[model samples]
Target: MSEPTMDHHRWGMVLARPRGLLTAEPFWSETADGIEEGLQHTQILFFLHQVPGLQEELEVYRRWSAQGFVHGVILVNPLVNDPRPALVDQLGLASLHAGVETPAPGSASIVSDNVESTRRVLERLHALGHTRIARVSGPSHLAHTHIRNTVSRQIAQELGISVRIVAGEYSEESGRRATAELLGLPAAGRPTAIIYDNDTMALAGLATASALGMQVPDDVSLVAWDDSASCQLASPPITAIAQDVHAFGRTIAQCVRRIESGESSFEVPEPAHHWLRRASVAEVSPPR
Candidate 1:
C-alpha cells in the first residue's frame, strides 16, 4: 500500500488556546465559517494544538510546508521576538499573521490599532470619573497583549488616573483569581473600574463581584475586550470593545487567496475596535 500524498488545494490555520477564545464562543466559529465561505475552491484546515511550546507548533507547520500539505498558513496570537515569521520565510511558504502589525518582509499581517483602541477605553473610563482603574490582561508575552498594556499605562498617566494591571491566561479561572485579588484591596486603594482582556474574564469578574456582595457600576464598573454574544447576554450586559470577527476572518482568507496566487506581500485591512456602552459602566458619585 502507498501513502496518501499532500493536498495542495487546502489552506491551513494554526491556533493555540483553543479552549477559551476559540470554542468558548461563537466569534471564532463565525470566523472559521467566513474563511470557508470566502474561499470557494480551497479547503480550509484548522489545526488546534494544546501545547506549551511554540517551537513544537512551528515544527508541525514546517513539516506541513515541506510535505506541501497546505498552500499557505495563517498564524495567530503572535509573540514578541516571534520566530515563526523567519521560519516561514526560510521554508519559502506563504503566510499571514493576525494580532501583529509588522510581520516579516515576505509575509502579510492583519492587526487592530491597539494603541488607539486602548486609549479609547481609558478615555471612556476617565469620562465616568474612574480615577482608579484595574486591568485583567492576557499573557504578557503576546504582542497584542503587550501593546494593550503599554498603551493603557501611557494613557492612564496622561489622564492622571491610577491604573493597576494583573496578568491572566484568558481563562475563567484566571479571571476569577485576578478579580478576587483586585477586589481584595483596601477600600480606599481598590479600583472603581475594572477592564478585562476578554469576555470570559469579564464574566468571571461579574460572578466574583456578586460573591463579594458588590454591586456593578455602584461599586465597580466593568468592561471587556473582544465583545461577543456572551457579553451581551451577561446580566447587566457587559460594556465591551467590539470587533467584527467574521469580517476579520474573511479578510484573512482573501489575503491567503492572494498569497496562493504568487503574491509575496500585501496588506489586509484590520477590523476596527469600537466601544459598546452598556449597563456595566456608570458615572461616579461624590461621597456624602
Candidate 2:
C-alpha cells in the first residue's frame, strides 16, 4: 500500500493537565516521549495549557485550523457536552481526542475504559473489608471524571460499601484540602480508605494523612489512578490503577498519522487499565 501523504509537516497537541506534569509526572513525560518517537518525519508541537476553559480551547483550535498552522491537532481531557468535535468537523480539521469515548464525526479517539477500571479498584477495596470509602475526583466537567465517579458510586452501592465523593481540580492543593476535610470528620464517620484521581493528588493525600497523625493501611488506605514512579516512592507505596500512558500517546500519534494520510476508517483501541497492588491497602480489623 502506498504511504499516505500529509498536507502539513507539523502537528499540534493541546494538553489540559496540571502545571509541571510534563516534568513532574512520569506518565505525562513518558507519553510525550512516546509521541515524539512515533513521529517519523513530521514535527509535533505541543501547547501546555493547564485547565484552559473549553471556550479558550475552541478558540485555539479555530485560529490554528483557519491559519493551517498545524496539519492536525490532538485534544486531551474533553468536557461533558464537548463542542470540540463539532467545531473540528465544521472547520475541516484533522484531529484526535484522547480519553474521550465519543469523538466528533470527523475525528478519531484514544480512550481509557474508565468504568471498568474504577469498578475493579472498588471491588478490590471491598474485598479487603473496607466498608466506608471516599474518592477525591478531578473536576466534574471532564467526561472521564464523570464516568469514573458514576462507576465508583454504582459499584460501591452494589457491594454495599459506603462511599463519599469530593471534587478537586486535579491539583495537589485541592487534594490536600479535600484530604483534610475528609479526615476532619468524626472518627466513626471518616472513611477507612481514600482514592485519588491521580498520583499527584494521592501523594498529597499521603502527606495530609501524615499531618493528621493517621497511619496508612492501618487507619486509612490510599489508592490513585494513573500510576507512576512516585506511587512506589511513597513511604508505604500506593496502590493504583496502572494504565500504559506511553502507549496511549503513541496510539494518538499513530491515529494522527493515519488521518493525515487521508485514511477515513481508523479505530484506536481503548487502552487497558488494571490494579497495581502495593502496601497502601490492608484488611480491615473487626471493631470491638
Considering every candidate listed, which one attains the maximal lDDT? 1
lDDT of model 2, residue 71? 71
Which segments of model 2 are wrong by more than 4 Å? 1-7, 17-24, 41-51, 103-107
What value of lDDT does candidate 2 attain over all alpha carbons? Answer: 0.79
Q: Indicate the worst ten consecutive residues by lDDT in candidate 2.
A: 43-52
Off by over 4 Å in 1: 1-7, 18-21, 41-52, 286-288
Report residue 177 deviation for candidate 1 (angstroms).
0.4
What does candidate 2's lDDT look like per residue over 48-86, in tens digits?
A: 344445666778778777666777677777788887777
Model 1 C-alpha RMSD to native: 2.2
Which 10 residues in a row give candidate 1 its minimum summed lDDT? 43-52
lDDT to native, each model: 0.81, 0.79
Q: For each candidate, C-alpha RMSD in Å? A: 2.2, 4.3
